[model samples]
Target: MRRVSAISWSLSVFLLSFFFHLLPLSIWSEPAEPTPAEWPPKFNALLFENSSGKLHVIDFWYDWSRGGSLRITQNQLAKLTYERSWDNGTSYLYPSEIHSPCWLMHIPPGILRPNWMEGAIYHGQQYVDGFLCNVWEKVGVVWYYEDAVTKTPVHWSWIPFPGEQSVHVITFNVGAVLEDVDKWEVPDYCFNNNNKLENDEEMKASAF
Candidate 1:
């Protein structure tokens, strides 16, 4: 029942103790604070729909686009691109007039729940993609599964209330090296003004 910077930190901290058995925990009072966890530098995966049973390949990277994160999904229809920025707003690209769903890209939990600590609860450990994970639930609604080895979220799901189709993700190649230039490309046919997004802040609020 202790606070850790991330799931990976928890595993490393405890494992390191076994090596330094003589070191007192008190001696680490001045240890540097750990950096907050972030999405992997690169990722590629296929998301399979449980309802329609369709599948699509999705790719992601941080700062891979114009000073923002990029998420590209490709299916038989066409490729859908979504880009969001912390400082600016969000934008999207698709062949038709379809608006991008926020779940297409990963968003940091810290941003969604600023006061997460007040009601955050650790739900012990779980396994995702064969990686040990730290399970966390915030305000009893949103759940996060972070890889203990990478300190990055491997899965996240949110159920609005009592019953609904829980939005979830299944990650593959958890942290594989990827080329940003190749994964972030938006097709030329997707630049119609009709597909542009609204204010990111407002859109995120509604999407979540």
Candidate 2:
């Protein structure tokens, strides 16, 4: 009887070990990082998220910004930075944590424009060879991102364009992503045709 009991106990232990190994790996570990295909939408990631040149860290644009201009020649732009008020988080208007690595413009009285309203997001970067992984002289150098449109305006005066004065822009945390300004129905973010943004630390970044 004793011998029979011992054999049964050993068998049970082996069965348990086999079942444990058969269980899904996730049962004992955290999930894997998502691929690019699974990155956006799930992480609530933004499509075509870019800082206006050579920032070492990743950032997001959450609001609209106005004033000042940036010079983007070829793929190169001015270096950029900002004050971090809201990190990654949840919201309705701003659905996820916003990474605004530039100005956190407070309600100042004088310089506020239509596009430069309160809670509007903005960013800038001065790239030497553009902000993509491709090498220089790469054909189709600018790869576009996927953006979901909300009620954004079709033409905002504050965005960076192929002109003498390019205003820097970035977006984050908003529930809907936007295409070019002409594709939506919102306000125009006016810009100063004369005073373009300087490619310096003071002009590119801010603290909240």
- Clash totals for all candidate models: 0, 31
- Top lDDT: which candidate number? 1
TM-scores for candidates 1 onward, in order: 0.46, 0.24
Tens digits of per-residue lDDT for model 2 on 72-126? 1222243332222212221111111243222222322432232232232222212
Write the residue-wise lDDT of candidate 1 on 61-103 in tens digits.
Answer: 4432234445455544544435433324434433223443332
Query: Model 1 lDDT vs. the true structure?
Result: 0.49
Give Cα-based local distance difference scores for all models: 0.49, 0.29
- For model 1, which pairs clash? none
Worst 10 residues of 2 by lDDT: 86-95
Could you tell me which 10 consecutive residues in candidate 1 have the lowest summed lDDT? Answer: 108-117
